[model samples]
Target chain A: AQTVTQSQPEMSVQEAETVTLSCTYDTSESDYYLFWYKQPPSRQMILVIRQEAYKQQNATENRFSVNFQKAAKSFSLKISDSQLGDAAMYFCAYTRAGTASKLTFGTGTRLQVTL
Target chain B: DAMVIQNPRYQVTQFGKPVTLSCSQTLNHNVMYWYQQKSSQAPKLLFHYYDKDFNNEADTPDNFQSRRPNTSFCFLDIRSPGLGDAAMYLCATSRGQGGQETQYFGPGTRLLVL
Candidate 1:
């Protein structure tokens, strides 16, 4: 079984600044996938970024990026130029390769962006 | 744009009443998933249907049931709803069962048990 952990229950960031959300997971499989999802007040879940275990290179979206440490089993999300729209609940998820596409998610981190 | 769609954005049902939530996808994905999310908590997988095959999570209560009649439609039926079952029900779809495949989510339906 795979378990994802997000230590920070809440986080705050200033507009135009950067913030990083921490995530860790326990998985026995060598090949897997890690993902970060964002849910806003509207209750829509949006994919932020993802990283593959085999790929050492991190994944980066326009303003979102990730720091994936395979050895430590850590995958953190970095939000650059944070905007008020970035304020949402973030979740970390894990899944193994060649299995049912069920995702094990962390508790989630509530992020607040301030002006 | 092709996307996942969940009906009845908000629902109010009485305790012990049976309710069914519907989901449709235009993406023609091979997998459809149902997730339950409580306030301030992460979404938990309830069950999923791959093509026409149903897969239920180990911890998902037996009161909850799912049906995938076709490639684009899936339904979640709660036989007997309890107060604890009041939460957001999300429908998602993916292209395949690959670990890296991205799952597109619908705007979840919020169920309120009276």
Candidate 2:
């Protein structure tokens, strides 16, 4: 079974500053996928970024990026130019490559963007 | 735009009562998943449908059931609601079963058991 871990339970960042949320996973599979999702208070969860285990290069989506270290089994998300809207609970998830594969998610880190 | 839709965004049910949550997708995805998320916790996968096949997680309670009438619609049925079952029910859809396929989520239906 794959398990994702987010060591930080809560984090805070000043508006316009950068913040990095750490994530690590324990998976035996060689091929897999990693994802970061954000859920605001009373809002829907949305995808932040994704990284494939095979891809050595990190994935970047506008202000959100991922630092994926396959060998270390770590996938961290970086939010640049953080805004008030970025304040939300972030989750890290992992899944194996197969049909009907279930996603394993971390507890989550509550992000607070202070003005 | 194509999106995942969940009806009855908020639900209030009494203990032992049965409740059903509906989900529809306009993306025409091949997979639909049901997840349970408690307050301040991560979303936990309960079951999913790949095409017409139903897959349930080993740890999922039998009290919870799921049905997919077609590619565009799915339903989650709780046979007997309990206090522990009070959580946000999220419906998500994906293009395929690939590990990298992005899952689009619905707004979620918050279930409250009184």
Candidate 3:
């Protein structure tokens, strides 16, 4: 089974600043994918970004970028220019490349953006 | 808008009563998944259906059951509601079984066991 670990339970960043959330995963499959999801107070989970295992180039989406080290099985999310609306519970998830609709999730990291 | 839809955004049911939550997807995805999330916790996978093949997580209790009659509809049935079972249930779908396809999620059904 693929397991994702988020080391930080809580993180705080000043508005317009940057923050990084750590994530590590254990998987035997050679090819897979990594993801970050944000759940705000509305409790709606939205996709932040994704990384493919085969690609050495990291994945980035606007303010949300990922530093993916495939050899080390490390996929961390970096939120740049954090805003007040960025305050939410962020989760790191993993899934194999094929025939797997289920995602293995990390415990969660509560991101708080301050003024 | 064509997206994942979960009916009854909120549910209030008596303990030991049977409650059913419905999900419909207009995206025509081949895979559907159900997740259980407690307050401030990461969503846990309860089960998922891959083209009618039900795959339940090992830790998921027998009290929880799901049915996907067709490509567009799925249901989560709690045979006997328990206090512990009260939580937000999320329904999601993806075009295929692969992880990179992006699983679209519904707003979710918040179950309250009284």
Where does candidate 1 clash, by residue pair? Answer: none
Ranking by DockQ: 1, 2, 3
Using DockQ as the measure, name the better of candidate 1 and candidate 3. 1
Cα lDDT tens digits, model 2, A25-61, are 9999998989999988877788899898988999999
Top of the candidates by DockQ: 1
lDDT per residue (tens digit) for residues A15-69 in model 1:
9999999999998899999999998887678899989899989999999999999
TM-score of the first chain in candidate 1 relative to the native first chain = 0.98
Question: Which segments of model 3 are wrong by more than 4 Å?
Answer: none
DockQ score for model 3: 0.68
Worst 10 residues of 1 chain A by lDDT: A38-47
Report lDDT (CA) for all predictions. Answer: 0.93, 0.93, 0.91
Q: What TM-score does each of the candidates earn?
A: 0.97, 0.97, 0.93
Residue by residue across A1-115, what tens digits does model 3's lDDT show? 7788898999999999999999999999998888998888756688999888999898989999999988888999999999999999899999888758578889899999999
